[model samples]
Target: MSHYKKRLALLLLLLIGFVLVSCGQPATPQTVEKVVTQVVEKVVTQVVEKEVTQVVEKEVTTIVEVQVEPTAGPFLERARTDGLRVGFVQEKPFGYVDDQGNCTGIDIEVTREAAKRLGINEIICVHLAWEGLIPGLLASRIDVIPVGMAIRPERCEVVQFTDPYQAQGIAALVLKENPKNIHGFQDFVDNPNLKLGASIGASELTIAREQFHIPEDRAIGYSEQVQVIDDIVAGRIDAGMYTAPFVNRYIQEQGPDSALERATPFDSPSYFNTGHGFRKDDPEFVQLWNNTLLEMKRDGTIAKIAGEFGYTDADLLGEDAKVENCCSGDNWQNRACLPK
Candidate 1:
């Protein structure tokens, strides 16, 4: 119990009390700091993600706008200036190059009249083989095929065919004095030894095979029908199957001495119906063609051209002639005459 001892004890006791108070305080501030840091990091990440999503959405919208815009109208306008490049297959009265190298035929006349109506001045005609015409159109070598292309469902998958300009049927051409009682496709099928000549790749050949069951071995395929007619005149072939209008034109062009005479046409409605060909993407050009064809049929321009080419009975609105519903509906039966 000295004064110095009491002072030292008092100081020790104060130090111990200070240590106990520090130990008793809570760690709430550290936990709060950690939570605040995590919250800030989450907010920054969300902002970055939202900005990225906005940029991607904008890019997608711009691409969709570009894709949906119309482009065919401008392309067709440019084509008008350069003259619509047209192709034709030399199939005699329908389309052929004359000795003067001029594209002259029923199809040529029709196309000329259409061009005049459409205000198109230049028409560059390129002569192509019958099989090459479709390929030429796809390759952009030609803008239109103004040949007598028969519209079929098979052809529609590849090219967009305009409204039919003319409708016709399959007929057999024989010597005038021949005593064959052939009237329709059934007659040819019933007769066994009859030698039928047809031009290669011609629609008539397909018709004969599909309808008459004409064997490939019995049918002779020539490069051109003129050669087949020549063979028939020389007694090499029995008969030649071709379009009726074309047969008449050939006979007329060769004069009375030509032994070819068209037989009565077969009754199959699908064997007829012909139209011009175009590219699938050329909707504007096709519309122009369709409008021109309608006008020609109404104004008798088509009839006049048909007469010039020896199509005497060229009826634009015949019972079987359906040219209006070409690319419009699900009516496939009559569409043979109105090919799409």
Candidate 2:
């Protein structure tokens, strides 16, 4: 009994000890490690997905903002801050250098007065050829053309013109000898053999093309109006077409020896109007110039200058003169006129 009881008791004690030891020991490190690794992997995957989505959304939004918004050009600000660079060609009554080499003309004087009102500190006159005025302006070499550029449809596509300050009628400049008996542009139409002369890229060219149906080659463009007058006197051209007042002034200044006479006469409301030319980017400057021109016309300042050039109030803009009618769109002639 004693031996059997001792063996059984020993076995039971060994079994209980094994069970207690097994319960006291911690679980396998690999099991806990695997659970922690699974949790960490899930959190990492969620974070990576969130980050990728956020970055993609941010990039798309940035791209759209960059594409849609366009900033303004810096031209107007620079012009006002650094003063202005005005351009012109030597043309009587509009722009010319005086005997002293200082720039002086009706348009030049008007522009100077307008610049004074614009709070500009300085004005630099740049003398360029007529054909180069617009190209220079577009290239940023010049800020404006104060040569009294007539507002026309094709030019309006490239540049912005201030409200017209003056208006004038069309006429033909012919020799006093009356060789061809040409009185008007209509005469050129009647006699298709005669070639008419005008400055290149001028409203006269348009008139010859649209109204008279004259071909481009027959228009006979010269670089300058003086050249046309010279050619007319030499009989290279039968007649030269230009503004009536311009021809009159040329005859007056040339004296009786010029042998040039202004024959046909025309006036408003069938006239061409001119204003200062500016780059299309600098609209604010054009607005200020137009406002200043209006003030000059109202204050008799324009009249004083006009008298110097033999222009009267009739040449000056009427109070009701509208820029839209001048050359806003397709308003080249009767198409643009407002109802009386």
Candidate 3:
């Protein structure tokens, strides 16, 4: 009985030990799987964090770059700057180079002063032919034309003109000893044998042809008004026609020995107004010039300049001189009443 009992107890104890070992093995496998799953989840979380950091860094960099970029506006990019360049034809009393090789004239003085007020230190003066002034402006070879250019309907189609700087009236010049007693356009046209001299590409020529009804052949075009005056003095032409200020300046500068005398203005009501020319799209430059001109007129700067050039009789502007059919003989007396 003792032997049987001992054997059974040993068998039961072995069986219990085996069950316990099996249960322990299954628990070890479950722990290993849980540990592996936790490790994989931790690695995935780290990768996701790295990707999110990279995306945030890129967004921050983009914001910084945008903040560093420059802003565009008028105050920062004013038109009157060192980059601005101006052009003009060498017309006396209006714009021309002085004997010192420096630019000095009414137009030059006005523009220089305006540029100074506008905080522009860089100014380039380019000399251009009178006829090519508009073309050079259109081609961007120059920024502005401050020459004594008149505002005409035909020219307005191409370029922008500032407010009137100086108003003018037309006049005819002839030799003092000449036999012709010219009063107006009728006198010019009535005499078919009379030859008229005018500057090429000048508004005066058009005015003479249209108002006086003179044939194109009888009207000779020269490059300059001085040439017309010279031709008239030399008896190469019967008469020379141009603005009153130019005629007065020529007479005063050359004196009586120049053999030229101004007759009464040809047409009544024919008034010409001179203004600065600019590119069509250059509104900033145009505004600057117009404001300067208005200031000059208000301060008597133009009158002072005209007085220096012996243009005392020359009106700075014509208020009522504009008359239709100014070329007719009936308006001859009316023309003289205009600003001379």
Winning candidate number (lDDT): 2
Which lDDT tens digits does candidate 3 get at residues 169-231?
767888785468776667767888888888888777886788667888888889877788778
lDDT to native, each model:
0.69, 0.71, 0.65
Q: What tens-digit string does per-residue lDDT give for candidate 1 at 172-255?
A: 788786557656666668887777789999877776787668887667789976788888888777788876766767767878
Cα displacement (Å) at residue 172, model 1: 1.3
What is candidate 2's lDDT per residue for 1-340, written digit by digit as tens?
3444444444454444454457784445454444444545565667678999999999999988755423235654555577678888887878888899898888778877788777765778899999899988776677788786767877888888777767766667887866787766677778878888998888887878787788877788889878998888888888788775786577768776878776633322256677788877657667777888888878888888877775656566755666666665555443122343
Q: Which stretches of candidate 1 lie over 4 Å from their true place?
A: 1-80, 177-181, 188-239, 268-272, 312-340
TM-score leader: 1
Per-residue lDDT value at 189 in model 2: 76
State in Å the error of residue 222, model 1.
9.6
- The root-mean-square deviation over C-alpha atoms between each candidate and the true structure, in angstroms, is 15.3, 16.5, 20.1
By TM-score, the better pick of 1 and 3 is 1
Q: Flag regions of model 3 displaced more than 4 Å.
A: 1-84, 117-122, 130-132, 138-140, 153-158, 167-169, 175-183, 186-239, 243-249, 256-258, 264-272, 280-285, 310-315, 318-340
lDDT of 2 at 332: 44
For candidate 1, the 10 contiguous residues with the lowest summed lDDT are 314-323
Model 2: clashing residue pairs? none
